[model samples]
Target: MSLAIKPGKADLHWLLGAMLLAMALHFSHFPLWTSALIVLFMAWRLLLQWRQWAMPRLWLLLPITLLGVAGIYLQYRTLFGRDASVALLALMLSLKLMESSTRRDYVILIFAGYFLTVTAFLFDQSLWVGGYLLLPVFGLTACLVGISYPHGVLSNRLRSRLSLTLLLQAAPLMLMLFLLFPRIPGPLWGVPQDAYRAMSGLNDHMQPGDISELSLSGAVAFRVQFQGEIPAQRQLYWRGPVLWQFDGRGWHMAGNDHAVEKLEGLGEAVSYTMTLEPHNRRWLLMLDVPHILPAGTFLTSERQVLAPMPVRTRMRYNGSSHTQYHLAAGLGSRELARALQLPPGGNPRSRALAMAWQRELQTPERIINAALTMFRSQGFFYTLTPPQLGDDAIDDFLFSSKRGFCEHYASSFAYLMRAAGIPARIVTGYQGGETNPVGQYLIVRQSDAHAWVEVWLASRGWVRLDPTAAVAPSRVDSGINTALTDNTLLPILARQDHAWLRKLYLNWDAVNNGWNQWVLGYNQQRQLELLSRITGTTANWQQLMLWLTGSLLLMALLLCALLFRRKRMPIDPAQALYLRYLAKLSRRGIQAGAGEGPLSIQQRAGKLLPQHEAEIARITRLYLALRYGPHAEPHAEPHAERKTMAELRSLIERLDC
Candidate 1:
């Protein structure tokens, strides 16, 4: 317990294991050099022990510690943020092992390892990560057991069992706290600004290959659970940002919301709940023409659902959207101008063709059909790896290159519409999702990222037109995989060739979804709902606290009762081993009489079983030492009794009557 008390060899070994496991958990977050440095420090401490080398001097250790701190500061620009602070702790903890010659130092390292284990949750609260961290936790607990059993009365295997038992015993209390404790409003893993690192998703602007680039990643963007049957692939247009202004090469948003003159739902609304991954953006991707918005979210003038705050964490929200709807019947002059705006003096050939269509077909509807006809009949190819475009990207796709992803077709089509006097804008969002048969939920990944065009019409108000569909109808009807011939760029999960692999992935995802919903997603509102279901009424904070206290007290009383009802004296392990040996010998007609010593029994048994005489003698000697020698004394060497008992048990197992 005191600083002067050095940890025994067993304790040191367990401490080393605990430290290494804890540091390995954060390898992904640490810089390569930082990871290497910590590894070196750990290796040095291990060598110092294994080779019996002297510990580094204070003067040398001080400089190394300062250098590590300086390195962390240089890597992160400050030694205070989440990453930097964790890096510092890992370095110091590993360095601490070098001078950990006392029990107090070893204890500090074990506690620090536990702290580091908890930090892993801050980065990822996934079910697998949470489960994996239990290894390091178990290792640290074993270190505590080693320290507690300094005399080594318990073997290593026994200590491991005790450590696991301790963890199992606390599971009920942990569950109680998780269920009844007051819940926080936001994400449990939310931390400082530095912790909200940039995530990959749709940006507000679309360059030539923005959507195509995003399509390469198969990471889940959001998941949808519907009240009834899931929507068809072609109808599942999860709307995101709408871009109105085009600055020559790329499409950008209008950077403001406009008031819709009129809005109406044309069909039955589809009720669904969305679990969106953090994308650090204000836009909440939802189905087209949402009628019921979740709290803290509103529909913009362009019909894009916007959250009040950027989604910096996983969010679950209930939403209802009409697949068919009358969106924005009228547009203000500013909105109209913005929608039709195009860059000056570019793609004259494309502009000329659009004017010809405008002259030939005087209606917006006719012009739209003409554009679709051109894309369908032209040698336009749908692909993930689009060739580079010139400054006039629209013209390059329409007349020159004629090969690009959804962004290319949509951008050129929108440009053609504006030239033909139709107010068309680009709408970028996910186009389709794969239904997880296990959970019966739709998982929309980034590979489903798509771009289409929306043009205003006098009769229909605003109509959605996907030019990519004209070139690659399979994209809308099936998925991105079917739309492209060279599906090599697509992620394996996004492909359809491996049905068995897909099913396996879906089964695992279903389990993860449950973990997310019931564990990480357990917030204040969920807690209250659960309480109402349990108590048949809404339980407030006071009632919850009372229930928690009563349950804890009841558990304590039960434990006390079990403790007091136990036998006064526990059975000796050495005696148990000897009893087993005697029982085996009795099968050979050799039984020990009352008050017979092990020496007399060994002499008689050895003569009768000459073939196993050596084994019988060894077992007897071990049993005698464990039961009657110095090891039998209460204050004798702690390991002597355990070692002898183990040897006797081993010999007894191999003995022939």
Candidate 2:
């Protein structure tokens, strides 16, 4: 007993499985080499168990453990933040497996497994990720239960049932606490900024390849659930960042837009509730030409939605937009100059062509038409992988390659309008979105990212135009899948193209949308709304506390009643006699266990009191006969029971500790 006993074999297996599942949660967070290191360590631990090898000695484990710590520190350059701490936790878990032997070690490993599950949540709080982590949580609990059993004795089915039973029993208490907890606004203050880097979103810059690169991803940018008719696919122009300055290479939002001008409505306004996913950016995308802004957001001069701060979590807000609206009927000298300014010398051929058209056409509208006609008739093809342009990008695209995506089309078109003596700028945002029929909501993905041109005229301050739409209108209607003749550039989900698969995608996305709305998007606003709904009036802290306290008291009373009822259930006659015998022994200075049977008590008393051996032995034999040694008739054991009772009373009165 000097050395701590090794954990049960079944417990080791369960613990190993739980650790691997926890590791899987972080697969995307770590580099391939780090993930490989974790997997190798896990496999080595499993091999040790299979070979029945002894736990690694402290001399070997300590250095390896230190090496893991050093590796994590070097990889992250610090061990003090969210990502580094999670990596350290993962490393410790793998190393701890190598030295796990005693029940205390097993307990520590299981708790580490729980901590790892929570770390996964620290990065992603989506419904599926949360649901997926529950498996490891159940496994860790079952492993703890299995550790209490003899080696190799616990069954998987029994372990699963017991762990699940425990979770089910604890669910009510968990839910009660969740509902009664204080509702706090804003983020929890611990979400890692690094964890959100891989998720792509629109920035304030629009380079040649920016939109094309975004089109490669199919992840949902946001979802729109309309109160009335959903906008047409071709009309679903959700505006985001606006770029006015072109520095010969890219379009950016710097040094152009100064003060935001309020856009006036000319038509009916469309109302919708937008569920925007966290992209760590401030722009709150809205349907093209919004007249009224959602709460907590303002309209930029360039007609872009701007939030007060970066969005770090899922958010839902109500907004009203105008599908057909006139913005800026007139522009100031400063605004006009900003729109018309261009780089000194790039795309000379494109600039020359635009000037020639303007001189010949004699009007802005005609010039626009002429430019559109050229793109439509001239053998210019629409593609994603446009050839790399040189210094004269517009010249190469217009006169040579003649192939590009939305950024190419938008950038070149804006340059043409400016060269034609017309004021114009580049507007970057998402275009069309697929409508999920199941939930009747719009799913706008990254692949829908687009850039269009905005031109100015004396009659109309600014006009929206998509030269890419003129060349490939299907991109606006049927989406990028049908727009590009070469299907290889489509996103993975769009490439599948099977009806059932599409249905499955939409259905699953609908389920996720529901989870996002009710769970991830449940903020302080929603909490107050729920309370108001429940009480049929506006709710306050006093009402919330009263309700919470009353519910908690009711739960406590029910639990107490159940426990008391169980305690009052009947006990067997032999057990009753044994309890009395133990009580009598305690009074005489000798005592049996609280749960000991007459036979076991007799054996212990006989060793200490051989003078009463005859009485003790007789009582033990009669009790065994009456309790377990059965008779055929109902009253056959009555005489034996009477003898056992008399003998037990005589033996107990004479026993001593």
Candidate 3:
């Protein structure tokens, strides 16, 4: 009999489901226009699949591809870097979906989906991102299984279930590999310069509205877990880059020509560790004055820490920061001149006011106090929406508008101090962070980008003074979100008043803190520390590799045994019963042939043993029924066949040769 073969609609539904999921994830990383193009392409492809419209011609696809490439180049200024390349890959995947008519095309698309999964990790490795990425991977695996095995009744569901099970089983092994894997010193390949240039964490220089833009983003900058004691919120000064030289509007890094020569001459050290997130910048943030550093890191005479290479990924480093350390004890005239330099023109009103204040005070300390008092007493508002300043921003901010973020107040304060001959510079970095109670760690977000002023006293070195803090003390004690109650400036968290949600948010932060510390923050220093922990102080790479290989081999052996144990021996209960029946019939002269059917064997047996003919017929009928039935009833007892088989065996024994 010939079986009819027809394609099922279920396959169509499965393919569409996979395509829709892939499209949703791919669109998230593209521009608005690119996303619109993908939506149009998907609708067009669906129409073609439904026979409502024809597929686009080959000639049409060429121009579309060229247009997409051009669009990516235009959007990112170059068809390079992590963002641009990912966008291009997403576009190609979408285009491939339009022409995916064959099983091979589907397979290629599934592999592309896996590549996209890894690419997403390159962008962000947070726990939340990892959780979101699992969906597409699962969908793609289902599509792969459905296409490969179309006829099996439970193939698609079983394949997906088994795949997830296998992945879960392998997770422990993956973690083991991740922990024990040797870390290379540098990038394996030359990364693009603009790979992740969104300018996260902190910037080296501060403009009028630089910190304002940074405060809008809710991205996390870094997480710190104190070893000995957590510093008070007021004392938490995470110093980043120091901006000394200033033009009319913006501030830049000071020239290092007058940098101090040695750090050993500084005061006592206060040791601490920091896990810095990727900022695409080389400046490292420590407590205050870092003395010791990892192998590739160096310290400048200005007491700023520098990494040998620009940090493109999460980095963890240990340092000894002495908050009381005196830097550049004997400040040279050249160095003092550099710190005193200011923009010649702008802020003329503020300059004249400073000169007048200098005449009254005649001391740097009193002048600094006066400026702080002015910020506090002048009704200056600390707001996200600050009024625009003219060429003389400081004059306008101090006299007319009197509304700005931390950078504005800081820039003006530093300029006024310098005008009074007090050596001052602008320090930019995150201020207060939300302390995660669950993890006992401080989680610093990008919203904490703050700029404060530091005035150099002859006896006190560079004494920190935050004029913004004097105006808005809540900003330094609590987070910026709490300080700025404007609903327009706060993120989604500000919309809700749920206590449970707040706890959930804190718990989620704790999980991300662990992920960043162990996965993204894993480095050469961490690797050596891990090795030493696992194999004592004398651990080496050769011994670690040997242990790793042995453990992997043992795991492989165990997994093989579990998977193949059921199929190793082919003697199941039904087959064993059939073999026994064949042996019983062979005792008589009528023996079953190798390829003979049950009916044929029964006919041959009837001729040899006429008395047992009925018995043999009953056994043959039941045997054929069980073997050829649409569904086998293994649990049902074969009563008649069992009696007949016994009688047949007796008759065969009576006719022994």
TM-score leader: 1
Alpha carbon RMSD to native, model 3: 5.1
Model 1 regions lying over 4 Å from their true place: 150-154, 563-565, 571-627, 630-657
| Best-to-worst lDDT order | 1, 2, 3
Can you write out model 1's per-residue Cα lDDT over 101-214, one digit (the tens) per residue? 876777778888999888887777789998888888998998887776655445679889999998987888899899988987765666675777747899999998899889
- Candidate 2: stretches off by over 4 Å: 1-6, 46-52, 80-82, 148-158, 255-257, 567-657
Superposed on all Cα atoms, the candidates' RMSDs to the truth, in angstroms, are 7.9, 7.1, 5.1
Q: What lDDT score goes with residue 468 in model 3?
A: 85
Better by lDDT, candidate 3 or 2 = 2
**In model 1, how large is the Cα lDDT of residue 600?**
95
TM-score of each: 0.87, 0.85, 0.84
Q: Give the range where candidate 1 is weakest over 10 consecutive residues by summed lDDT.
A: 146-155
lDDT of each: 0.86, 0.81, 0.74
lDDT of 1 at 144: 83
Question: By TM-score, highest first, what's the ranking?
Answer: 1, 2, 3
